[model samples]
Target chain A: MAHTSNYILGVYDDEDVLLKAIKNVREGGVKIHEVYSPFPVHGIDDVLGYKRSRLTIVAFLFGLLGTSLALTMQFGMMTIDWPMIIGGKDYAPVPSFIPVTFELTVLLASFGMVGTFMIISNLKPWGKAKLFDKRITDDKHIMAIDLGNNQLEESAIDKLLKDSGASEVNKKTL
Target chain B: MIAESAIREPLVTGGKTVHDVTEDISGRVEQKPTKTWMLAMAVSLATLAVGGYAVMRLVWDGIGMWGLNKTVGWAWDITNFVWWVGIGHAGTLISAILLLFRQRWRMSINRAAEAMTIFAVICAAMFPVLHMGRPWLGFYWALPLPNTFGSLWVNFNSPLLWDVFAISTYFSVSLVFWYIGLIPDFATIRDRATNKISAAVYGALSFGWDGAAKTWSRYETVALILAGLATPLVLSVHTIVSFDFATSVIPGWHTTIFPPYFVAGAIFSGFAMVLTLLIITRRVYKLEDYITLQHIELMNIVIIITGSIVGIAYITEFFIAWYSGVEAEQYAFINRATGPYAWAYWSMMTCNVISPQLFWRKKIRTNIAATFVISIIVNIGMWFERFVIIVTSLHRDFLPSSWAMFYPKWADVGVYIFTFGLFFTLFFAFAKFFPVINMAEVKSIVKATGEKKQA
Candidate 1:
């Protein structure tokens, strides 16, 4: 197991500057356990080589579940239980089911996306965020890259950060 | 040579800093009440008093206080519902759709539109939730539970139930979307807040943001995902709303054209509502630097597209009704043209279809006053559009036995009036309290736009 407060290499600048350093670190065959940033740097996912996300597939499946629930509710209500004809229509009206089903489909898809997203991002309520520096949200852009310090030495990361535009570098334990 | 070429525009105006963004937004919150604020408070309060009293009476009494009856059970209430829901469309459309399209001009007005969406939805929900004879038990109709006592399940096939789900989901999602966008800006405010109480309140809502790349990234990711989800719902929501009438076997109401038509109408009116708010709020808040004429022009373009869509839908409705040789449908359209509600029908055409065409003129589109007026006109037209559709369609249905004149009793008009009053009251409060601009996003855009100018 990795040490709780083991040394992690962090870089800070603007997004464009940090993105290049992240690419270089990965290209040097360094395995990154995670990257923490204040904002999403577009196109960084490609550099990280993360695969296309499964959120959409999850959303589609939730939509199917919604469709199933919508159908069963209408079918079971109209046909089997308390069948009553209002407005001189048939007992099992199909077209009328479209609206609710559509609503449920949307609701389920949205809920699924948010739930899966929260899981993947590892965001929890009221936990202290690991801070390299507090100005990360301001003009300063930063990258917190978890270098496998159980294998690599702290000196190598210090050199790597100084080589990049890291105005301030720190050792953080994940 | 390359360096000289690149040094065109500055990223920020010289000496402008993060404090400026906070100060500019919080100006309304901190400053003593100006004459305009006083005037607005007076107007909003008046509107609220009238509207609140109207709603109080509506709630105290049952739905029978309205002009609805056995045949045309949903008249003014439905008109209010559709109009308010339609009004909400532009916010999501402007914010999410424009973000996806990478239209940087959207920065000016997106936040206000979102506020409007939330408020307008609040108004829209009022009629349906409390419109029932037993307003308390109406909750039973909405909750998807096993009904032990009623001995019958709530009809899942109902568009009413669909509406319950749709409106609630729309309200919740829009709030989430709006609040998430404001978080970074709220933090910016929290840091700069004058008092400890203000700082604590703003700080807590800001989720302890430190603008690290991860927070912004995840925030954007959440926003983008929500936007992606919301865009289709913008279309789907109105489509389902249309289904509320269309799913019925009522001759004039039953048609496939409604989904697309309602979607178009919703967007058209939604843009109008946005235009109206942006014009007033821009001037009121002195957001001239942020809400430029260019942003208004882009919104006007959307308005124009949706207006044409509505016009085409109107024509298409007639064509389909006539071409299909459905006698009831034909009579319904004809009656709409030469009916008791003919004035409303014509007004809808004139306001919704004709007035929006002014945007084709560059001068008119850019002029804030003209844009504002036209927005008000579109709003009026859109409300009548619902009225003309609902009243005209039902007042002369297939059976003459069921035909009757539909008019809002005093109480019905009050419900409409008060609901709008509630909406404006909410909006006025929002304007007073919150930073109407998503300051961080605007700063980013301001930076990006400046870069392009330099390039």
Candidate 2:
């Protein structure tokens, strides 16, 4: 609710129009802070030229860590730490270790990827979201341009947004 | 963009715009409790109270309150355990597997189904812990924690211990997956919240989602990877659960086919449970347009496939038991069909194998009332399936003198009722406080697979 920065937000009703407007606004040499939508507008990232997310790499690394930890824990306990003959099987039964290993791998990978995603995306429980328009979470899509980031005059940027099919353009200090 | 097939039926039937989708889905959450919801909660809470008393008796008076004899030491407890666990599979299958396959129909049902998966697993976990009699100690002992008593670690080689890991991992991971999916939809509710308390609670739950394009891009990637991870996790969960029996020396329990057979049965029962709940939910909530008849038919088809697989597994088990020429194994299958538990076996056959086959008829599968009835029947049959496998196999062991018939005590029935009450209670609360459908996902697909264009 505290106002700190000046901004102009173009409100769009259709996803197709929003996609085109993102392109138009960017081509008009205005820097876009972000585009917000109720749902994931397919190809909006491509139009915005956002790079593909590398969370998968983080997941893979976490999975490897889980695998090794599970192996080491089991092997250390069952084989070296306090070996006891169970069901007359080998003290270190590798095959028997697969189920727990797989479970841990999945557990860590999901938790890791999600944790990394929240940290990077600023989606934290205590964080405050800058709400330019509540309708963005309903039916509207929003293209927010920070006046400080763009070199274009405020009137010229508003004209570009109108020409690009934004239903309305509004300015706010927030 | 890939064009949708011309012949494909529309997934969302109502000509709903984005605003309408949000309103229709979140409308329930924002409203005061309906009379039906109150009545349902009262019934659920009453059941939970009665069951809770029985659980306290069992916990206080020991597991001897149940009719678990020496021979049938694992009767209702294990049967219910496997039954509930199997019932937990369909949610992940719908959300994770169907997503990987690009099945758009799951969009409407996955949220509720995943919710069911978590609740069913909770019910399932209750049995084993309660069956331990001293669950307070058993719970900690089950984990591979370093103990003061000689620093003894849990048996890594035991399937039961593997089960400890599997169930815990499955529960936590499913919860995370469900919560992550709920965040965006929570933001929808949060933004629309008019009351201060409602706004604050939902806002916290939403984690302040801004719906930026880059975040959505990452969100999609994380969802896909989680789906990929969950697919195998679902399959592995049931496989390990089967290992609890398959690794045993019991003639009827030890079979190579148990893994695939149990997995199929899990999906089979899980979908039936989903249908049962959704049919009622859609009726009460009036979400029929989103959960169309087509969704019911498609799920019924899945029931058919998995049900057929389970039927074949039954036949294969008998064939292998006879072909193995082992007297104990042969006697196990014969005793299941012709012995004291023949009633249970045939009920399983009639309900699970024969009943789902009826779905082959288009008329029966498409009828909501029929689907509802059969869905209940399938669940009953599935419960009996586990009963047949566990009690029948254990009752008449090789030592005839030690063999005894297993009978349920009031406590057994009461404890089972407790889970039913608990499941419904949790479900009703979830249906009320949460948006029962994934509004965000449904919105993404509405324009593409909707029966009519946005108004």
Candidate 3:
């Protein structure tokens, strides 16, 4: 039984060096599992060739969903659930629904966006995540590679990281 | 990225490193409050004490404490509510909106704005709490507690209910947003803390953050999510406040434009308050390098746009009333322009609508003295806007017999003072505590801008 294990290959030094190393590794046809950073480096998505975020798509759909829900809830409540004539207006009043509808649309969309953001980001409320380099948040950049390939000799990977300007290289099996 | 960006040019042409940012901002906050902050605090406190006693007396004497009668049921209570609500807007802008836009300049001013938001909301909240007359029953309105009363559903549609929900939501969300951003910086202080008690206090708030890669990423995600949530909530909160008036039967009150008008006014005055604080803070904190003149320039542009929107709203109200040919609406406008509160109306116009135009000059927009004074003017103008709207409208209702001008009794004035004092007291304390700017975020932006920095 081959239980495939993923290893985190850390190339820790600075952004430019890490970027060059990652691109070199990718060009060498290495399949990376993930890259972690302390902060987002601009154009990194293109560098790693990651997919554009689907979060926006989800947000739009959720926003529409919210809008529909708000309009239905508001219109239905005023027009049907417990409609009372106020200020000589009719039982089903559109003008009066403006405030509630506006509020609800905002409420739902904002909530939906937040919920979607958290889910897509894969964040749990508690517990620290595994980190490649602690100092990446301060003054470092890091690239992580999964080291399951037979060709990916640990020495060669470490050599590649150093040659490409990695200040440090670490391999962790998790 | 840091090593790579080491080669990059700095954004502000020439700027300092992360260490410099820390030193500069800490230096800014470290100052003893200027004669100005002290003077303002003293004045606000005195006003509050005097006003607070008057209000207490009124509460004791019953509702007759104010000039409020059958016709003018709402007086300074509503005016103060509107003023405070308008004041709260700049905090949301500085934090949520600016964060979304990735504006680096936000760092210098956001602390003051967040403090302002918390304070202004406190001020706004006092009106409804006390105006309910049976002050103890205030909790009843927040009501339907499981123990005392059954879970009677709040009328989902009532603007008053919406105010309760919106105000509380704004307060809690702002607190979380402000606190979350402060945590890492708090950790920095914790590390630098000499006193054991100070270390413990900051350590608890900092949540053991060590600026690790995973921690920073998590912080960024959380901050973004919170900011995204807050942007619309900020808009909704004020819109709900506007609904308080728009839902009413009064001719001027019943309009579709109220939400946008109120929001614009809120943002306008909010920016003014921010300008006032940032000016003093930048000078006192010696944060001239961080909260640069450029930031003030950007704020001036916002103030002008919102100010213009308010001006348009004023014109649009006149146009709509004339176009609708509603006699009552026309009467409201006529009374506002020419009646007993005509001075208030004109003051609102000159201060809010007219003053923001001075920002067209780059020099004036960036000048701390000019911006500070304009902000104060805008704030005063906005207060009068609410006063004119509430007082003038209520003063002359549809019935001629019910027409009566409001003279804010000592109690009415006192409560307003107490509210401001409460706000300022909280603000002064907040300044004493937290790192007003998100140091981590600013460092990130500094890195992003690829500046050649020196600390």
Candidate 4:
């Protein structure tokens, strides 16, 4: 059976209040969905209990791949493919390959990291996003709690939000 | 958050709130282009048209259309290439290096400077590709591709080939870094758009950014790593460019100090160009509070430091030449100072070396008019620096019989004008459409350091 998804949206005028409210609401045993703000709030992720990101690992791996690919391409071409005596240097010339290797490593690491980030975050040109509150992109901080995911009743969640200093509480169904 | 030293001045003045930042920055994008903007665009387009014709003629006829002497195989084209590439360095230095240092002032200017980096790189690429004479054929040939030509690959031992890889990688990575920063700002504009078309366009540009804490956390991490990657990448790019000259056996070009010297000179020139444009941009867009006099003074200090480094490098070159006891190297330095191109050499000394020394005086550093004039002079001096390095070194070799003075043709001047046209056209378009200042960043800083601190 098809069902509607319900969310209780708590709008706050300032980030500090929203941050403190998040901790308070969590301690009140209500499961939170997400918090949206106009700008990145310092310590919001840690307060929300988000794990540290591993995108840097992805970048490091991609950087290694770039280094290998560059070396293989250069070595394969210079030595194995068609060895020549230009500039009176050796066939492979590893020292000379440093510049291209460095460039390629940076190129792939950044590209791979960003590409992975976009995919994981669902950031695409055509991707649709749920706009919880329009002011989330302006000055307001929005904390959206999925009613279906929480054990508490809708009224209880709304009361918790308001008591925790929400400027206004609204319900949204999608 | 680290408590910023109370002694320091605020990065963002005017007691702005988060809403005020969005309104002020996005307001320009939402409004129709001002008369002044249209006037600037018209001038840029007209210059582009003239430059475009020159390009078409050069392509239609040949590289012969350029004022290049066979004797000076690399003249204005190479000089312009090095000059433009050097100018691209400051953007990365501000965005990447300054970020690593946690210099908060960079937030205000990095977006525009990074945009300048991309545009400058594009202009820089034009000289070499066009210099190839048949760029349509020679462009791809420069790469190390598996080709139809029997078993022939690009020489890995060659610095010119390193340049091909370095420039391409630098351009691509800088574009990525700049765009990643823009996405959040673009989403801010997307959400604020009153019209559907503008909303859809900015939405696509923003790549559907959700302001969730998790996404933002990841975004910050990505930005830091990219900044880390780009710092060394920017350094490597200029080092490789210097390698193109230093690896050569020529007298002036064979110095060991070329890499550091070239890098310092690049930052000197790049900051000058940044100051020149930003001085004009801040006034035109009325962003005085964001790009304050403190920012200008800070950049002037960078000019003083890098400009002095460049000055020392110049003095070192002379010392090395005399100490090396190589007759050709000595002749090269002496010729540069007292020969036919002595005017250019002295101009480089006066503008790149002596002029920035004036910034040591606080009075001169903070004066906007003086900063603007000296910025222009610094760029002119940098252009001469490259010209002197390239032409004087090549003009007189051991062969006195083949030595000839280079005279630039109309095409040489026109093509240079073409790049200026292209750079400004791209820059003006960026200014009009994209958020010139990073609104999200400014908002974050405003929260921390704005005159009205949040409770």
Q: All candidates' TM-scores?
A: 0.85, 0.98, 0.79, 0.98
How far out, in Å, is residue B189 in model 2? 1.0
Each candidate's chain A: what TM-score? 0.84, 0.96, 0.82, 0.96
lDDT of each: 0.74, 0.93, 0.71, 0.91
What tens-digit string does per-residue lDDT give for candidate 2 at A28-132? 888999899888888888889998899999999999999999999999989999998888889889899999999999999999999999999999887677788
Q: Residue B409 of candidate 1: its Cα lDDT?
A: 89
Which regions of candidate 4 deviate over 4 angstroms? Answer: A1-3, B453-455
User: What is the lDDT for B292 in model 4?
Assistant: 92
For model 2, the stretches where C-alpha displacement exceeds 4 angstroms are: A1-3, B1-3, B453-455
Q: Which 10-residue window of candidate 1 chain B scores lowest in summed lDDT?
A: B1-10
Residue pairs that clash (backbone atoms under 3 angstroms), model 4: none
lDDT of 1 by residue, B91-196 (tens): 8888888888866566657889999998988888887776776677876667666675677777666777777878887877778788777766666566566798
Against the native chain B, what TM-score does each candidate's chain B reach? Answer: 0.93, 0.98, 0.91, 0.98
Q: Which predicted model would earn the best lDDT?
A: 2
- Among all windows of ten consecutive residues in candidate 4 chain A, which has the lowest summed lDDT? A127-136
Pairs that collide, model 3: A15-B1, B9-B450, B9-B451, B10-B451, B10-B452, B28-B285, B51-B414
Query: How high a TM-score does candidate 3 get?
Result: 0.79
Instruction: Give the alpha carbon lDDT tens digit for every residue of B232-280 in model 4.
Output: 9998889899999999999999988999999999999999999999999
Q: Evaluate residue B324 in candidate 3 and report its C-alpha lDDT on the 0 to 100 scale.
A: 92
TM-score of 2: 0.98
Q: For every candidate, what share of the true interface contacts is present?
A: 0.27, 0.77, 0.09, 0.83
Best DockQ goes to which candidate? 4
Interface RMSD of each: 4.4, 1.2, 5.1, 1.1
**Real contacts retained, model 2:** 0.77
